[model samples]
Target chain A: MIARLRDGLAVYFCLLRGALAARMTDRADLGISMIIMLLADLVVPLTTLLVYQHGAGFTGWQRDEALLLQATFLIAKGIAFPFCFGMIWTTTELVREGTFELLLLKPRSTLLLLLGHSFQPEDTGKLLGGIALFCLALPNVTIGADADSSAALLGFAALLLLAVLTLFGFALLMTCLSFVWIGNSRLQEIFDAVSAFALYPHGIFTRSALGWLTWVIPVSVLGYLPASVLLGRPDPALPLAVGGALCFVLVVIGLWRMMLARYASAGG
Target chain B: MNRLLAAWRSTCAIAYATYQEWAAYRSHMLISLFIGPTYFLVQVVIWQALLADGGTIGGYDRTALMSYYGAVLIVSTLVFDFADWNLQMLIRSGKFLTVLLRPMSHRGFALSQKLGHRCLGLWMEALPIWLILWLVFSIRLVPASTGWFVLSLALGFLIMFLVNYCVGTLAFWLTRTAGARRLIGFLRDVCAGVFLPLALFPHELQQLLFFLPFQFITYVPVQVLLGHYELAGIRLGIPEIVGCQALMALLMWGLSELLWRLGIRRFSAAGA
Candidate 1:
């Protein structure tokens, strides 16, 4: 299992390097895209801060706790930037345009190839801005004041990586659904819209109904649960994280195989 | 009079064409029906949680906030223009030539097409949701006066439509304006009170947002609908909303036309 994981990571990095090379050829355009993404990254958290300050307390969480949640979201978004958003759009487009045939000819797995082709050089800017925010908010985070910063950061990182995997897997699964359903663009839009809810602190959604949706939909997992754990709030079910991570991997693998089976070659 | 008739006829034809375009993609529409409501449900759930402890967050109660957000979702979606996507495609495909050659004004045609699309969206999608909300929630109206509510809501759609057009027309100057579209979208959601009530924002930010035209698009209209604005309040607010929208619309219109002319000149000079 370890060796297989290592191999997958290696392939992922190799694909990323190739994408970077392709994007670097248009440095000026890439720079503009990056700037735009960075601006977008700042708008959400800043706006949320403004909202929280005005509202005083969000659900039960205080102002600082809300800020910490926003920071964690930024961190998870930083992880997602390079990993998922770049690929999801292209995956949908390829399926729609019947361009997956070219991908099939590639030696790499089609899922990886599709994701690899979808890299946005601009996302690096979003990642950097997120990192900057995370750093700025790191010291102010008091929810987990008892825990060592190092331990919290490590735990945060683990949860963030898990979140990204879950998000990417979910996106992949959605893209694969396009194989069965034509004109699934609305599904993509719905995904985009629902994901926007992640911008707010999840503490605002502590009720059981919303909680179920968060866990089942896994959008809250992207930022909320991990942030909670890191902040030294009562730990969420460990099994939830482990189960979600396992489900993500299994789902992605299943969807990829299903997509491959349905792959009718586009005309060369 | 004849010109008005001609314009009306052309607008009707354009409206039909817009409907047909959307109708051709039946699957997308069906999916949108499912998807839009599901996303709205998620938002409702979140808001429900926030309000569970009772209202009075940033001076908004649960019912009021629901009315505001429900109006936001319905109104924003109703007034949304695909002009940005259209402008981008036109520029990329070098099809601005066809639009320019037409005897009718391109801007007029574009605006008509957008309004037509929005109208179709309202009939096909929004009306159902509005009916459902009215039936299920018995959503209370705040503006008290029906006439005022209707007028304000119309103005809201107009402001939103103009903003979309102005933003989209920037594509004439910028090679790619997706960033601008996204930025404007984010602004609309945050400042315009689509995601949360604008009342929930810090007083300073709320004050600043009041100055911006975005609030006129979604926030003020919804506020009016929820009876947050009175006839007296409308006397003060309506002028501000309309004046700001008109000023922004004129400024954007003039700027986009200038850019469009310049872009056309550039294209012609380059022998494209």
Candidate 2:
């Protein structure tokens, strides 16, 4: 099992390196794309800033705290987008052009191969923006150095991992949809709209909406839950939300397998 | 007069054909019905919580803020243009040569295509989203003055097309323009008051945005719809601002034409 894991890592890194090399052919475009990715994600945070500056804010959340929550979402997106999210678009194009069979013929797991080959270096701008905002906001918020702070840090770390996994699940789900949906480029826009709810404080949402976000859609895991945990104000439903996120990922994986089985290649 | 009539007829034909071509992707357009409302819902939740105490932000009460966002969604649906993306793809793949071979100006053809696409969007995206905003959100988007609003919105549409066309012109020089296009497009949207109202911006930033051509695209139209125009401490009646929007549209047309002339000289689709 260890040997197989090592082999998988080796294959993933090799394919990632190739993707990087291909993207490096256009360094200027790569740099601009990265900046664009960063700027695009910063829009919500900017609006939050302007709102607070204008003496309005999400109830129960301070300006910096709200920024921190949005920063957490951006960081999660920063991590997932460059790594996993490209699979959706790649699958769309590959399937549309009847070239998806090329990936299927590889000896490696098709999922692994697809994930590896779809690395997007430009999206690292999102990571940079997130980290920058995180650093900027972390200084302003108070965190006691007591045991609870430590526990909160631990919970935040765990929830952040779950957040990344949740995003991966979403990417996987969209990729699976792309198999049959064909030529539909608005999948990302739909995801963008849904996940946008994660950028704000949970206090802003109505009880029903909050329940849906936490228990059904697992949107809370993407940012709000992790940020809340780090703020040392963990939601009472944290454990349940975590479980929902895990189940969501598991369901997505199952869906991916079913779709793969159904994918009677474009036969290019 | 006969030549002008022929131009009008061909424009209509092109628009109708483009509309039919895109009707196959109506489901794609219908997705906006979901996305627009979802976004508005998020805004609703946030603003409802913020102003629950009866506090106003930037001189807007909850009702006015809701109207602003609702108008934004509707106007955005009407004036939306992907001409930049379409044109860049054409240029990159050397498919624009086919356009040049046609008698009509590529700009005119692209505008006709946008008209067709937006006609579809008006029904599939704008109208339904308008109903959702009205029926579900209880946000009534009664324009301050209907005639001036319509005129301003038409100007907004023209400005948006000109700006995107100029961005597409960059593909003639750059081997890859996706990043540049996105960067410019995003900045344009930001300045145009898409994500946040211009009133929410700092005084200095608002002043700077006033000089930029983008606010003519969405901000002016929304403000005209809302029946008030004030940004960066400058106030204008609907007629005056709409006039300014028209002037900006003409300026954008001149800029786009200049860029097209300069960029077209660089086009080399020898093999393609």
Candidate 3:
């Protein structure tokens, strides 16, 4: 089992290296794309900053606290997007061309192969942006001075893992849907609108919206829950939200298999 | 007169054909029905929370701010154009040679296509979202002056297409323009006040924005819809800003034409 896992990791890195080399052929475009990705993700945070500067802020959340919350979401997105989000676009195009079967014929897991081949180096800019924002906000906001700092950090690490896993689940779900939906590009927009909620403090949402975000959709785990943990203020529903995220990931994996079985060649 | 009539008819034919081509993808536009309102709802929640203490930001109370966002949604939906992507793809794939073989100007053809696409968007995206803003959000977008708002929006549509066409022309020089396109597009949206009111920006930045053409795309139109225009501490009436929008649109048209003339000389395409 260890050997199998090592082999999978080796193949994934090999594929990722190839993607990076190909992208590096256009050095200027690569740099520009990375900058664009970072700037695109920073718009909301900038808006939040301007709001605070204008004397209007999210109630009960200080400026730095809100920034930290959003920066955590960006960091999770940064980690997920480069590693997993490419599968959706890849699936859409391959399915359109009836070329997805090439993956099934490979000796490895098709999902792993897809994930391996879909590494987007440009999206690492999101990670960099997240870290920058996180650093900028961390010093201003106190975290676990009164309580156990190490425990809060450990809790943060665990929730961030779940956050990244939930994003991976979202990518997998979208990729699976692409196999059947075929040629639809608006799937990401839907996710963007829904996930926009994850960037803000949970205090803003209505009681029912909070329930939907935490239990039904599990978006709260994507950023809010993890950031809340780091701030030494984990949500009362933290355990339940984590369970929901895990369940969400499992359901997405099942849906991926079902969709793969249903996929029929559209190419002649 | 005969020649003019022929051109008009040709434009109509092109627009109708483009309309039919996109009608099959009506589901794509319907997605906007979901995305636009959802984004507005986020804004509603954020702004509602921010202003829960009964204070104003940038000369806008809670209701005014909601109305501003509502105007942004509807105005953006009306003036949205992807001519840059279409043109860049045509250039990069060497499909532009086919356009050159035609008697009509490619710019005119693209504009006609945009007209058709936006006509479809008007019903599919803008109107529905407007209704939602009115019904669901209770943010009625009653324009301060309907005539001026329509005129400004029309100019905004022209300006949007022209600015993007200028960016698309960069494919003539760059081997990869996707990065540049995205960067420019995001900057344009930022300068145009899509994410937040330009008035919220620092005074120096707002002063600089007043001179940039991007503001003519969304900011001026939204301000026109709201019945007043002010940025960089400068204020103008609805008719005055609409006039300025027209002038900016004309300037953008000239700029696009100049770039197209220079860029087309670099086009080299062999038959596939």
TM-score of 1: 0.84
lDDT by residue (tens digit), candidate 1, B1-272: 99999999998898789878877766665554555665666556556665566756666676766677667767776667667677666765678678777989876787778767776777677776776567656763335556666766676776666667667666666666666677676667677777667665656776687667777777776766655542212234554554555565566567667766775655531123
Q: What is the C-alpha RMSD of each candidate to the true structure, in Å?
A: 4.1, 1.6, 1.5
Summing lDDT over every window of 10 consecutive residues in candidate 1 chain A, give the lowest-scoring window.
A48-57
Residue-level error in angstroms, candidate 2, position B209: 1.6
Looking at model 3 chain B, report the run of 10 residues with the lowest lDDT sum.
B263-272
TM-score of each: 0.84, 0.97, 0.98
**Residue-level lDDT tens digits of model 2 in A196-256:** 8999888888799999999899999999898988887778998999999999999999999
Highest-DockQ candidate: 3
- TM-score of predicted structure 3: 0.98
Ranking by TM-score: 3, 2, 1
Where is model 3 more than 4 Å wrong at Cα? B270-272
- The alpha-carbon deviation from the true structure for residue A15 of candidate 3, after best TM-score superposition, in angstroms, is 1.5
Candidate 3, residue B207: lDDT: 94
Q: How would you encode candidate 3's per-residue C-alpha lDDT over A210-249 as one tens digit per residue?
A: 9999988889998889888888888899999999999999
Ranking of predictions according to DockQ = 3, 2, 1
